[model samples]
Target: MFSPEGPGLRELAVQALSSVERGYDLLAPKFDHTPFRTPDAVLDAVAAALTRMGPFGNGLDLCCGTGAGTVVPARVCRDSVTGVDFSAGMLAVARRRALPAGPRVHWVRADARALPFAPVFDLVVSFGAFGHFLPRELPGLFAQVRSVLRPGGRFAFPLVAPPRPGSPAYWALLGFDAVMRVRNAVWRPPFVMYYRTFRPSDVRRELTRAGFRVELHALPEFGRRRDGSPRVRLVVARRPAR
Candidate 1:
């Protein structure tokens, strides 16, 4: 699932052996060419959905590697837009891009678990970065998002449905997780990425605990699964307005 411009097998092997932040630093230049980057289609769908939900001001993109989803907020938010990540390398790559003519764009290097911001953002969006966090970390991560948002502001992201049980996709993810678990058990500074850790129920509950009113909006552009469930959904969790 990697293009020729992406990291090669030897480079990927070296990255896999490094810590998550360092691995991403090494992969930053070629990340967009890999399947690891959030897809443009997903970003477009979220942007359209947010356009309906907003006329927001001062947006933040949490874990915004390479700034793929930064454009979404720059379109919907009236004020400035900030993209935050722990990887300086990723932020450097993002800073090189010519942003659209809308809100002013700022790239900051910060970890999502402990963001260095006030409760100033009216909207926050994150894409394809949750798998980097473990289940226990969700409470703190969601809390961090809530802390940075203004009352009634939303923290949104797309959540794809889990692959069908016994299907090739399902087995592939399961196998990937199994491999990761084993690797972490033996490796130092564990690379914590898993496909199955974030479930809808668990996420909703965690969002609620984090003081967000959680809701889901089906993304029809991705179509429905055989079980009649939306294949892709936008998880829009808003901090309650006082």
Candidate 2:
């Protein structure tokens, strides 16, 4: 599942044994080479979707690892964009890479659970970071995202539909989660990634409870499943204009 430039078995083994932050810190240099990085296709698709929904003012990229999500906001937002994450190493890599300078990119080191911003953003997006948050953390996490967004602003992310029960992908994810559980049980500072935990129904319900008006938009690029459901969708949750 990794490219030739992605982490080797030894590197992955070391990372799995370390804390999440330290693991990511070590992996950050090679992250873009892995399947772990959000694909450019997804990012482009999301940017297009947001463009149709916006003329957004300022944007925030929640848990913006290496600033990929930040680029989406920079494309769509007119004024400014902020990429926030707790990882200094990740932020360092992001800063090294050239992003559009006109929009005023600001990198902040902060936890997603407690964002360091007022209700100033017209758009906010996160990419591939939800698996770090447990189910119980959704309310507070969504609340934090809502808190940073201006009234009538949006928090958007892309979510792929789950694999079929007997599929190879399904079994692979199941095996991964099982291994993660065992690792966490025996290790310190758990690397929190589980494939099956964040189901669409539960996420939609939690987002609604967190005061977002949730909508699902199919991303035609990823095509459809056998059941005629979308293989991928953009979850656009708007904060009420109160």
**Residue 37, model 2, lDDT:** 90
How many clashes (backbone N, Cα, C below 3 Å) per candidate? 0, 0
TM-score to native of every candidate shown: 0.98, 0.97
Q: Tens-digit lDDT track for model 1 on 135-240?
A: 9999999999999999999999999998889999999999999999998999998998999999989999999998999999999899998789999999999999
Q: Whole-model lDDT for model 2 versus the true structure? A: 0.91
With a 3 Å backbone cut-off (N, CA, C), the pairs that clash in candidate 1 are none
Q: Candidate 1: where is the Cα deviation over 4 Å? A: none
Best by lDDT: 1
Give candidate 2 misplaced runs (Cα > 4 Å): none
